[model samples]
Target: MNTASPTRKPSRIQKRNRKLILDAALEVFSTHGYRGATLDQIATCAGLSKPNILYYFTGKEEIHITLLNGLMDTWLAPMREIDPEGDPLEEILRYVHRKLEMSREFPRESRLFANEIIQGAPRIGPHLEAGLKPLVDETSTLFEGWMAAGKLAQMDARHLIFSIWATTQHYADFAAQVRVLMGEADVEGGARAHLDMMFRRLLRP
Candidate 1:
């Protein structure tokens, strides 16, 4: 793994180059899908040579895996932000809005993750099972507690989360289709309002 040593801090240049490579790789992987993406494409995109890319990453798979793992964190951040002590419906609606913002701002990342999952998540399934599942289990328990206390509408907490993911990520993962159907309209804004209304109605006590 091209990891920084625990005892040593990476210099500014090293951090910059690594970020350049990863950002380029995200574009390539999102555009081509993992199986179709290549180190050469990433190198070209990064404006770096293959050797430099290799210096930062081992190969295409390593870059892809790194991107996927990092994306899991980005994907899970909003969920992690949920405040158990906050108002339940607002917290959940805030999650919905944050996810929509991610779809708008991180469309490429959304596509990259969607592609990985669509292809059976061969590169990142383990991370999903290990990281995503636990957080989801905990969130589900939280939702269950809220419902039991009459703070939320009773429903399958797991499916509620799944529904939220599907609805929000659709804007990013299916952007081409969305563009074709909706043209250059303010899609994210519309989605935010719609999702807020939908979830509010569904979850409000």
Candidate 2:
């Protein structure tokens, strides 16, 4: 009897290098904003030469915009999952949990994009209009369906979504305050509990 494991995947140094550049760019962009960050900083952060970074990407703006565009889909997906056909409170709470999970795992990416939006999203505007707006519209219709069915509380669906996004994203965007106020140990837990309580208050049935 064969007890061997599955086949190994191919090593992809170029792909890995590109990912390194993207990650380093995310950190740099988050900290310094777009105009403030330089190619040398990103190259050093990725431990690659500036030419090498350019070999993978044309420029810093390209990488930043690529990261922003990639993030748009993921950032929009949790809202897309808010099913009008499913249990109302449960669906909304699941979205809340997903957004929190994203905040935990991808804080730097969150900060990078947040920094862009705070400055008016020059690079991300088309992606936001073409990608994110459509998803929000779909989910707004879903929310409207839930409200009309009497499954959810009466509320402006778009504003409800806007508030949920603003509140959940604030945790990561303002993580410094969260740490100072709550201490490091309970930050994640406190966010979870606080979000639950807030949503429950909004969604009481």
TM-score of each: 0.94, 0.89
For candidate 2, lDDT tens digit of each residue in 59-153? 77788888888777777778877776789889999998899889888888788888888889888888888888888888888887888887888
User: Each candidate: RMSD to true structure?
Assistant: 1.8, 6.9
> Residue 109, candidate 1: how far off, in angstroms?
1.1
Which pairs of residues clash in candidate 1, taking residues 3 or more apart in a chain or in different chains? none
Q: Give the TM-score of candidate 1.
A: 0.94
Off by over 4 Å in 2: 1-11
Choose the strongest candidate by TM-score: 1
lDDT of 2 at 53: 89
Give each model's whole-structure lDDT.
0.91, 0.83
